[model samples]
Target chain A: MDEMDNQFVTSLKENYQIVFQEIGLLEQAFTHSSYVNEHRNMALSDNERLEFLGDAVLELLVSQYLYRKFPEIPEGKLTKLRASMVREDSLAEFARECGFDQYIRLGKGEENSGGRQRNSLLCDLFESFLGALYLDQELEAVNQFLKKVVFPKVDAGAFSHEMDHKTKLQEVLQRAGDVFIDYRLTNEEGPAHERVFWTEVYCDGQLIGRGQGKSKKAAEQDAAANALRQLNE
Target chain B: MDEMDNQFVTSLKENYQIVFQEIGLLEQAFTHSSYVNEHRNMALSDNERLEFLGDAVLELLVSQYLYRKFPEIPEGKLTKLRASMVREDSLAEFARECGFDQYIRLGKGEENSGGRQRNSLLCDLFESFLGALYLDQELEAVNQFLKKVVFPKVDAGAFSHEMDHKTKLQEVLQRAGDVFIDYRLTNEEGPAHERVFWTEVYCDGQLIGRGQGKSKKAAEQDAAANALRQLNE
Candidate 1:
């Protein structure tokens, strides 16, 4: 490796505490599909594969951290918390914070279009980075890296950053002394084993929003979520 | 504790190496919602709360374990695998295997209906079990228990299974020397940032199944899943 490349590797190690046995894994994590399409036969794969693996690992680590930190919260609350934390926007923010944009190799057109700063791209790269970390070092190393970096945010309630619409709506209704908010199942279909239900949420006899899910309970939750969104709007 | 209860606790500790610090926690884990409903003034909480916490803990633990074990698999694949391993069916099976069915306190009606063997009920109880463990000991202890018991089936590749209908349809068509398989994007809606897609999958020029999802990719997967089901039928 040249002096500049050596500095890049050293800097990454210093920042992430990850030593890339196959630097190609790291490179692959940063190489977007646009970059690969532009350079046909360049003998480099896109980061999609790595991103796919990293997404799971990141989710697992984050979920585990939350469960350990909060013993009092229920599953529904935990699911919502985890969803907020691992959502695309949060992943993108983490990617930008890690300074992955500069290292990401994108096609000229994508670069021109500011693809490096795109939330979707950043999220993909973040996942790809996890994939690379898992392959290059192993689970322990990946766990260590996440614990040092990601776990702190989870501990500080970084994932539950926003008050969900449902909670907000409930507060609004309760404060108004209205308890007429009801969610009713409108329709259902599919086999008994995997039925899907459509639900509509109403407040004070006024319809607000509709939602669908694999179960009546899930559909009701979705309806509540939609109502929350409408209230926010 | 009564003689039967003491014996049950003793047997659990002797056989499973699990010593519950708060016996009430373990008792609560086995207390079904039916029981709570029937005996409204029992001053005992239902297992729903525990199930919720346990679900998160299980997912996190499974994700971490899988990441360490199969460092090569991508996140999407790993997520699917983890989902399969930790789904209601698997957890219910684990509950039954652990003799949880015998101890679960159910209502008379539920007991008559053989709720002990019901996957949904079993799964909920299993989550409660995890919740009890988490509250009684710690996250590490719960992880250790899971690793020794439930996680092994997954690790042993007992439930490592896959089926792709899109691929199957394509294969059947190719083998039959026909080009009758088609997938069409029927509708797209929602915000541009979080657009959802609807798709229809056809085989031999016949509309076989339909699906909807958050993205074209997910819609395609749903379509494929539906198509596979139709083929199986």
Candidate 2:
């Protein structure tokens, strides 16, 4: 039997409660580029391809879940919710919770470099695993896995901060209706290449907050952020 | 009987060969917000919810097809490929080919504004229809529908240009092996708020192309475009 026919399949079954009919897919999902590079004689592809597929699946599931859960929310707000849920940091946290890091098969160099502890590595691995799972058993099995692991965090308000401050501020203001909120450039300095910009955000005619940044867009974002903070207080 | 149960369902069955068991889903897919707003007493919802669902379904289907078809392409390239395929323009073209615009239920105001002819509206309609199809009939039917309508265009070389020029140029250079590509900021001008930046793209220590744009990133993209055009020539 191949490497995948043994401990790999058993461990997936035992730990994750995942049973793979196409065990090779499960194995490939755990196999990193580093591992494949180190093991040239063995025929094994890396998880990057699977990671690609998994990322889409994960996004769709999260998006669907959010859409159903937040019936009253608009598309833009729903987008932010999805983004926060699927962002690198949250996916990495999900990976850590699932112990997906421990299962990652890396080259000796990457393994020695503490690849397992790295959030990026773990996040990619989680995505890769999900991709493989989707292929092996399709969406039903994948949904079960996510329901057991990921969705509960939504109820705990863990993702509340993940929403963009500017968007949140706008949503709050827009719901109140017909309020003119404007961001104006107040100051500009430094060289053209490394320019600094200061912006003031006004609610009606009163300056609510001021902020500075390296670009006009950045400055506006900072100003909005400041306004959000002040308004919240 | 509802509007969908009458000629709408008959036409879908006749034209698209799509016999939706849950015909209500197919109806809602084409039902615009304007229709729901105009007919407030009618227990009809707009297609936005299905549009959201369909967008994800379309993405997943496209991703799966690409993954299986192109075994040699890297994930990044696959992502670019997917982006090109699902982009509003391409999807709008797909909608036009499918004649989705003809069946869309729009508000009278929107309809008078030539909404059906609008690419964005048609594209959303196509996605909403697909979303509704997935809900009613599932993946097999969706796959069959796409095979008959979508995948043929892919083979006719319709999708070849959707991938970014920079990545294409890089891929070409990389295929030749051990080549260095560098994008340099050649010049910066105009005001900080409306900056015009020039960039030069270098391949293997030689400048291949130069371009200017409003932002550094845009300038680099222009430079990359120039390089690709030069390389093609």
Candidate 3:
């Protein structure tokens, strides 16, 4: 291994205590598509495919974790909980916490454009890293890696605040009495590929808040969150 | 075990040549929500939670399979192939082939309503069964089970026709000479939860076919499929 590769391996060992059977896979995971596009002679593959595989790995592991942790929680709640944990921002936060941002290789253009700090790129990097780990050591090693990095945040209830905005809004509204709560779809816009939904939440026939999202349920939750903020203010 | 439970276990062994470590989980896998509601005194849990976990398990396994099988294919195409394989209709077909439809428990009302042969219910049952298998024996056992039941169909190219309609259409259109193909979003309707998108595919600015779907890409694909069908006719 070159000095750079040796440093990378040593850093992983020092930080997470992870040893890779195939260090190439680990290097590929840190490789961005833009970097590969620029360096054609190196024959290096980007992290997109690894990101795809790692996304599924992360989904299954997170699902398994939530499945065991909340034995009595219904499937819908569990789904929401899993979503909160694995969303782009959360994953990006985890990647930054692990200092993965320092290792990603981006094209000069992307680097100049501040791609290193982008949430989507960081999230993809984290997932691709997990994918490489799974390919190198299988699910158990990936699970152990997550037990060190991701699960503690979940255990500390860091994501709990993002889970149920609608429920929280309802609780706040119902503090007065048994009031009628309704969410109505007001408008939808954008192209078929990126449709936006707008929703308004009403408390006893009074329009409390309006918000928008990519889906109706998300829009409703957004409206509820808005209403909660307004009510608190 | 009761006679019915014993018979269920025996049928699993005879049909799939498999045995579960925790037979109760297998039983739970087959229990529908309606059945639990009807058999309130039995304290039987429904398959919904298992279905959630199984859905994730199925995604990872299918993803892993596709990732290995087509190393040359891009992540986008692999994702589409995975979706085609694990869709509700496809899963229902698999469940029916495995005789899982006959084993799913339904309330008398649901039975009267013809829920036994419903695709959604059958699909849920199949996923729940896989979930149960995973819980009882872990991913490798579930992988073995899919190798027997699901992977063969994939190996046979049973689902290839459902993939890449747009690409197929493009091949046909480009056969004559250089041609410009365009997909235009015509309209969208329905509530936020069930929004429908309509798209028209045009050849050199001439409208060829129109179709609608849940998303823009799906609508575009549907339009392409319709164009292909019209051309074939």
Candidate 4:
């Protein structure tokens, strides 16, 4: 390994107690596509594939964790909680906490444009790193790694603010003697990859608030949040 | 166990070579929420939570399978392949083949409404069953069960028809010369849960085809498919 690669490996060992049996996979995880494009002769693979696998890995682990931790939380709430935990900002925060910003390799243009500090890049780096860890050491080791870097934040209730807004709206409305509440999807628009969904919340069949988001559940939550805001005002 | 429950357990063992150490979980897996609502005095839990867990479990397993099976396939193609494998229609078909339809219990209203043969209910039943198996025997057992009931269909290439239409269309368009092909999201509409997306495919800045679907990827695929059809004619 080169001096930088050696330093990267040593840093992981010294800082996080992580050792990769397949050091190449570890290196590949940090190698962004832009970097590979700049060095085509080196024939380096990018982290996109690893990011894909890691996304699924993170999802399953987070789902299992939430399922066990909050047995009383229904599926809808669990879904929301899990989303809050793994959203781009949260994953980027986790990546920053691990000091991944120092190790992620980028192309000259990306480096000049401040790609390392970007949340999307940092989130992808964290996932790709986990994907490499899973490939190198399998699921249990990745689980152990997450226990150190990811789960503690969840345990500390860092994401509790993202609790079920729909349930909260229902509770707020029901304070007036079992008031009927409903949420309906009003419309959806945009391209296939970036679809926007609009939803409206109603009290006793009267529309109280309308909001929009990328998914149905998110739209419902947005509508509920708007309803809550209106009531508070 | 009641007589019907015993018969259900026996059928599972005899037909699928499966056994559950925790019979209550097995029973709960087959119990619909409607049935639980009707049997409120019994305090029996429904399968919603199990279905949630199972959905994640299925996603991971299918993702892992696809990742390994198609190491050369890009992440986007793998994602499309995984979607095809675990989609509602596919899951429902797997449930029917496994004879899960005979075991699922519903409330009188649902039973009268033909819930026993519903694609959605059957899909949820399959997921809940997998969830119960994962909880009872853990991931390996669920993997083994899918090997028998689900993975074989994938191995047989039953879902290859849902292959990347965008890629196929690109190949077709590229045959004449270096042609610029573009896909744009034209519009989106419908409710949040069932949001519809519309996409237009163009060649050399001229609109060739337009199509719609519930997801961005699906819409793009629909557009590509439509474009391909137009080219063929």
Q: Using DockQ as the measure, which candidate wins? A: 3
Clashing pairs in 4: A192-B216
Query: lDDT tens digits, residues B1-233, model 1?
Result: 66767777987888789999899998888889889889998777778767766776676667667666654454566667778888889889888887888888899999999998899999999888987897788667888888778777754446545324454445434543556667899999989999999999877678878989998868877887787667668
lDDT of 4 by residue, B108-127 (tens): 99999999999999999999
> For each candidate, what's the DockQ?
0.17, 0.38, 0.60, 0.49
Q: List ranges where model 1 is wrong by over 4 Å.
A: A1-57, A64-73, A105-114, A128-233, B1-16, B19-25, B33-46, B60-79, B107-114, B131-233
lDDT of 2 by residue, B108-213 (tens): 9999999888878888888888888887887678878888888767655467676566656665676546688899997998878988999999998999999889
**Which window of 10 residues has the lowest lDDT sum in candidate 1 chain A?**
A159-168
| Model 1 DockQ class | incorrect
Instruction: List candidate 4 segments past 4 Å from native.
Output: A164-233, B164-233
Model 1, residue A77: distance off in Å is 2.7
Residue B37 of model 4: what lDDT? Answer: 91
> Which candidate gets the maximum TM-score versus the true structure?
3
Q: Each prediction's Cα lDDT score?
A: 0.76, 0.80, 0.89, 0.86
Better of 2 and 4 by lDDT: 4
> For residues A92-185, what per-residue lDDT tens digits would candidate 1 score against the true structure?
9888877777778899999999998899989888888987887788656877987776766754536534535454455455544647778888
Regions of model 3 farther than 4 Å from truth: A1-4, A162-233, B1-4, B162-233
iRMSD per prediction, in order:
4.2, 1.4, 0.5, 0.8
Write the residue-wise lDDT of candidate 4 on A1-233 in tens digits: 77877887887898778999988998889999999999999999988888888988898888888787666578888888889988999999999998888888899999999999999999999998988898888888888888888888866547757667776666556545667778888899999899999999889999999989999888988888888889889
